[model samples]
Target: MDAVARVRWAQVGAGGHVARRTSAWWERLVAAREGRAPQRLVHAVLEVVVDGSVRSVDMAPTWGRSAGARRVVVTGPVGSRLLGWWPLFRYELRVVDAPAPPDHVLHVSDDLPLPADVLDDLALVPALTWGRDEAGAGDMWTSNSVVSWLLERHGVTSVGPPAGHRAPGWDAGRCVARR
Candidate 1:
């Protein structure tokens, strides 16, 4: 474990046009069916300052096997090569050095004082099945789940989305990690 000076979590809007639109529409539909107003949807990513440099931890679509260290690719049902969707369902668990947060960020959590051991554990996140309700948390596994899972694994439980926004599949990740 190196000297981790700062750690924070960000809630950002979906980066892709289709993803943003689809997520918003789905949230609206679910909220209406449940008789509640829709909350804005966001995704979670972590930023850790170790040895005076920033490292980003996030899960994102592979987009044709982009290369980087500390990246692990996980398969999704619809995006699997067996389903003829080679890169579509492929996701990478990225621990990128000196990375910037994605565009359209909604909220950034205050810097959290996490142990160096916790930051070290980021590279060891489980390769859970993406887009599946395997955790029985009543939601599919997603990028949000990955963030939550990593946090819960290291006993960092106080972080979550800010006001007026929701991180879908977050509970699923925590639930799975608890097991």
Candidate 2:
């Protein structure tokens, strides 16, 4: 890394209750739409930061099934491009204006901000996944994986698939879990 090298990460806010509740609502809505029994709920909160300092936090539901629900769209390069432009997309933590690269950070107690793109595409699943993967919060991988599988099964070409894990992820091979 050089002096010009920079990195972007997601911010987990201390106030993410609203987003969590909203995510749970949307999860049920999607489950109902898919004719599946809703079991667990999900939420989304977006936090943007720079140099280990808080910038902004927004907490809200990720999905809006109702007509009046707000929509948020996030579009960025896929694959390796993400490595260079991680900050462009929603992440668990982001540091845009750091003088030096992040050496090692810890997940401290914090509030969760609202997700960036709550409507349209590139939301909910990815945002929640980030929350799970990076923030060590939200167990949304199974639900998100199921959503992607169902979408692909029905030939829905609106959103892409989830990253990591196989088709079922933790949802499958676990009888105690619900889909």
Candidate 3:
């Protein structure tokens, strides 16, 4: 196998209009209670380069069945007859080629020299309950949790939200990954 070239991460605005607005409002409320100014809300995604090919890793809602080969797992209350019936309640871990990150990207981390083993572990992230505070990290699991979980699994701990910004559920991922 060719040596792994590079790994980097991008912090982007939440994908949908509703998600963006809701995240902003929630963060604002939390910040206000803590006596700090609200930080810009963001989500994390990874871009990995190997043998000159770029692959993006992220978790997203299973809106449809078109994820094709990129979808790794569909997780969340799949056994519950209520939530299992709706795609909105399920999420997928995806590794897509030549990914197009959402608009309004907030920050991009410097490239990290990661080992190839980390890529092999991408599909192995635990299928934790999404949108639920399963880790007791004080926040619900979301895409940010997935990214942080993968990073933590490989001992990459310093990557985080940029200055004056926040990525909710980040700590939750790390918390769960550590167990």
Tell me the tens digit of each residue's lDDT in model 2 across 32-133.
Answer: 887986544321222234334433222223333232322233322222334525543322222112133222222222432323321112332333332232
lDDT of each residue in 92-166, candidate 3, tens digit only: 677777776556676677776676556677667767677678568877677788778877887778788888877
Q: TM-score for each prediction?
A: 0.79, 0.24, 0.81
lDDT of each: 0.68, 0.30, 0.70
Ranking by lDDT: 3, 1, 2
Residue 31 in model 3: shift from native, Å? 2.5
Deviation in Å, model 1, residue 149 alpha carbon = 1.2
- Tens-digit lDDT track of model 1 for 1-179: 44443234343445567767877888999899889999887777777776577777767776754575554534344323354256665676767777766776666766666566555565555555676676578877787887787778867787787778777788888887898
Best lDDT goes to which candidate?
3
Give the Å error, residue 177, model 2. Answer: 19
Residue 99's lDDT in candidate 3: 71
- Model 2 is weakest, by summed lDDT over 10 consecutive residues, at 1-10
**How far does residue 74 in candidate 1 sit from its true spot (Å)?**
5.3
Q: Which stretches of candidate 3 lie over 4 Å from their true place?
A: 1-16, 33-35, 77-82
